[model samples]
Target: MKRPGPLFTLLAGVVLAGGIGITNLVTGTGVTPVAGAANAAGAPSATEAPRTEPPKTAPPKTSEAPKSDAPARADYAGRVEGGGASVAVSIRDGHAIAYVCDGKKVEAWLQGVTVGGKLDLKGPKDASLAGSYNTAAVTGSVTAGGRTWRFTAGPAKKPAGLYRAAPKVRGKASKAGWIVQADGSQVGILTTDDQSAAAPVLDPAARTATVEGALVVAEPISGVDGAGEF
Candidate 1:
């Protein structure tokens, strides 16, 4: 009998292995052949991964100023009753001032911000006044020293809006001032080279008066400057 060479024996072994792999595939044994089976060996493949997408991220949050549906008025003055406290508000070029005081005590020099059809004024000592108005009158409240009071004011008078005057006595210069109260009263002072006087009581219906034989008048303020001192 003739015997097969070593090379022939090796070829026969490979054929038998391939036949067994084919049989395993046809029988659905779930077994993969070792030849050309890099994935089955748990090795990384050159083909791209499943191509998964990244997760989505959310947008950032932002803070902005509040919007209003009310129209803007340049100058305003308001008052609250019962407390005898009053407010003078002025606005120009979007800047404003609110002065809350009794002209004697319990006063607050509040800053005014341009608020719609309404006025809001605050001060350095935690005093504040807020209200709404038209060309005729203003109504609002003032909060100062932990208390809040309500008032209504008008615009047809002096010391209620703006006042400015320069008097000359015997060619000497003097200064005078007056403010109208929400209670239909007047508060004023006169300053000369030597003295200053208290608020003069005047007829609520009059804008000019004679005090100590001195002619006094209260003028309307038409401008605002962030609660500029009286």
Candidate 2:
């Protein structure tokens, strides 16, 4: 016979190698073919390594507004919008007292508690005052006599706050309200028998006033430890 060609010789070598591998697997002898042997031999692997995820990262934190301390005792006085009325507020130990006066027939007394530098007070005739306070000023609105007005009041010194006197006139109940401003000016009113009029001048030094021919003391309406003198 003629000598075998190169192709036939190569085919014989391959078959011999495959037989040896099969023998190794069946008899547990010699190096067995591993799952990724082709990949190790520089061919692409049919089964790739398990896909790994990148390590998880945490989210960033957020910013917030700074907190402030509440005021223990403070006084605020200011005028309503359009100079239509005057408002005075006093806060002590978290209690608050407010007065809105037009220096004439329109006035209201409001009382409530102060929380987190804010005040919400109510009174007769659907009167109400809502506001916020700080070291610099108190700003908000007041409603009385079916109308509402906004205001801003700065820090008030002593003798510059709300005042009142409720005395018996001729065995009948009478009431007076006053607001002493930071500029030493004053606005007040007297109400008796369902009638309102301008109030008498108050003696700030002694906190006294003469009403209906009777000597009565005008008491400072402090938010501290005392109910308002209606």
Candidate 3:
């Protein structure tokens, strides 16, 4: 047996190292790619941005609308179709009261319960009024003295509505009604027993009227008060 030279030993070592490398590759234990190895080392990669879920978004909000319904309390005044008469209506709760006058012999006081802004009122001598109302106005037709007329009445403010006066003048039964128009005009009628004539001027501030020679208190008619005594 002879000793191997340094060159021969070096050659043998090189061959052994090559064989071990091939065996590692075949056994699935070879060094990975630089990029893959770095990724596996738990370092964040430029190609893979930090996984961030899209910002959670909330749905848009909505506002609720107010409810629309018939008014619980209201007063309206207007003229008839031909302007031959003035009409006034007052409503409180579900009850309604109305008055129509020509400032002459044609006059009526009507009352009834309102249903869903609809009015169907009846008065003396077959007088009747039918209509529908809203927050703005009332539209309806009235029948009296064998005649019918359509009318539209707008909202009436204070000092402009229906007024009534009942007092005994010269010991006789007497009654008066006034309709203060929205345009500052007015019309009314006074009745004593079977006679009818023009009504006296009514002072809204004082709520009074002078009848013949006597000063009488004028009551504002309202559906709340039922206007029953009228």
lDDT for 61 (candidate 1): 75
What TM-score, to 2 decimals, does candidate 3 have? 0.68
lDDT of 3 by residue, 114-153 (tens): 9888999999999999999989998999987677899999
Better of 1 and 3 by TM-score: 3
| Regions of candidate 2 where Cα sits further than 4 Å from its true position | 1-65, 224-230
Give the TM-scores of the predictions, in the order they appear. Answer: 0.43, 0.69, 0.68
Per residue, candidate 1 scores C-alpha lDDT tens digits across 1-230 of 98999999999999999998899889989675575478777776678476578988888778787765333433445555765655666555444555555545454546665556566777766888777765666677878757788877565333356443456645677655545654555554555674555445544345565655677664545553222332
All-Cα superposition RMSD per candidate:
10.0, 7.8, 8.0
Question: Residue 196 in model 2: shift from native, Å?
Answer: 1.2
Assess the local accuracy of residue 54 in candidate 3 as a C-alpha lDDT between 0 and 100.
90
Best by TM-score: 2
Where's the lowest-lDDT run of ten residues in candidate 3? 221-230
10 residues in a row with least lDDT, candidate 2: 221-230
| Error of model 2, residue 122, in angstroms | 0.9
Between which residue pairs do clashes occur in model 3? Answer: none
Comparing 2 with 3 on lDDT, the higher-scoring candidate is 3
